[model samples]
Target: MKSVQKIMPDMRHFEPLPDMDDRQFQQWNALLESRTGSTLPLERKTFLVTNLGMRMREIGCRSYDEYFSMLEGMEGLREWNILVDRITVHETRFFRHPMSLDLVKEYVDSKPHDVDTGKISMQVWSVACSTGEEAYSLAMVVDQAFKKRGDESYFGVTATDISPASLNTGRKGIYSERRIKEMDASLRKEYFTPLSQGEYEINEYLRKRICFARMNVLDIDKEPVGKMDIIYCQNLLIYFERSSRHDIVKNMARHLLPGGLLILGSGELLNLDCPELEKINNLRVLAYRRVKEPNKDQN
Candidate 1:
């Protein structure tokens, strides 16, 4: 046999990614905070570097500075969305916080009994809803509450997130077995259709009941939907700076119907004094109720 000539792929094209220095990291951090109201502390620098490096490599960027420059102005809007999806944590599952679900069940159970049958319209807002788990969980709990009480209350969940990709996932309403594994078997059977590869999809009726929209929590004041009976915002405020968190909470409070529930992640906020909201006294979950305005004649 003739001696085969060794053929090797070109190595010159495979340069190592440039390390993101402190200044570059700070620049990206500020940019992220400005655009998304999320903070990346010094300890998360490695995380920032990894996510940025992966995106940069995909786009053949030579340095962090180059990538930063690319993520500016209207031309970078699409890329910025992709980067947001990658950098933002989307780790969530059905009923990830059982206390929060229990609180929601309580809120649903407390609905006035004198309402016209099937005329009780309850709207829920699931902020920072990663995928559809939290939103569907709310829907299931609310629906179960109504069913258990033999009421035909009409309820819907509006799920919002900053990540377009995550919103897309929510719209699809498909989740892996691991996502639903811990959920109660009855809920799984009732709301999901088992699919190939251990995946479950939300039933058509439940999926239709939730409207997933791409929304940045920072721009919540611009929400077009009317005030909601329940605004469930959990596991997201921790990523924001204190001022940003307060602003988000205040704005979200503005969207709550009087006496509506505004639930937050436990310990996510302390002493958040919104004049319109009074904190729920539950030790297991951090929550607030929008205070109904006093009547004009009331002293």
Candidate 2:
């Protein structure tokens, strides 16, 4: 179970928040969809009720309707951010999905040497990277591939999420020993510094290669991030309506440079018909490759 962080009210006493009715649930679901492009299905009513009840208690709001009313207009924006942070899933670890990471490593390893710079220059984006594990995992694989080839490649990762709290944790680049236990001993030793406690901090070399930012997927197209060689967006679109998922994927496809890779959680979407991309045929992975840039000399 995902733990909900508490934001306690200053008051000494308060009544219990009222249970959310069907109408109230609809109202809350619609608001979430409008703001974040994520929808809460009926089965998640208990999850919604639990998280909302805690937030309501923090503000001493008694009724769901009253709390819903408070979330109106610009005044409610800050509270929404807090609510989003509490509700979004952040259960991830280093190399959580080995198959996806393997595909990423394979792609990087196959790249031919750059003719001009004599090194591969790669840009990667980790969409909805909660607490930085996925972003850092990507950096590890890319960096290792470059080292294996004995080349000084230029690579950077941009990690984005909507939750400020999660981004803050990611920026610190610190993790408990349990969080990194599954990582290979050699990689862990090479990339992390032992801290005072059992926690470890990512080495400066890898930390400096990633940039973490706050972004709402609904506003993805407006963000100024340029093209990327790899865009990893896993475990995100499952919360969105099907149409919204398609729209989001289409916009992400636009961010991919020619021959760039787009990886998603297996079964997140099937038959994504993007004219600029072709589906990668792997039963163990969900990925697509944008059409390779044409060779000028051949023309």
Q: Per-candidate TM vs. native?
A: 0.92, 0.91
- Candidate 2 regions exceeding 4 Å error are 1-15, 293-299
Task: At residue 93, give the lDDT of candidate 2.
Answer: 86
Cα lDDT tens digits for candidate 1, 1-299:
89999999645336677777778888998998888899888998888878777777777777788788888999999999999998988988878888888988888888775444635678999999988789999999999988887865788899999999999999998988987888899988998999999998999989999999988888888868787899999989999988889988989988888788999999899879789899988999999998988572132
Instruction: List lDDT for all candidates, in order.
Output: 0.87, 0.89
Model 1 regions more than 4 Å off: 1-15, 113-118, 294-299
In TM-score terms, candidate 2 sits at 0.91
Error of 2 at 32 (Å): 0.5
RMSD, candidate 2, Å: 5.8
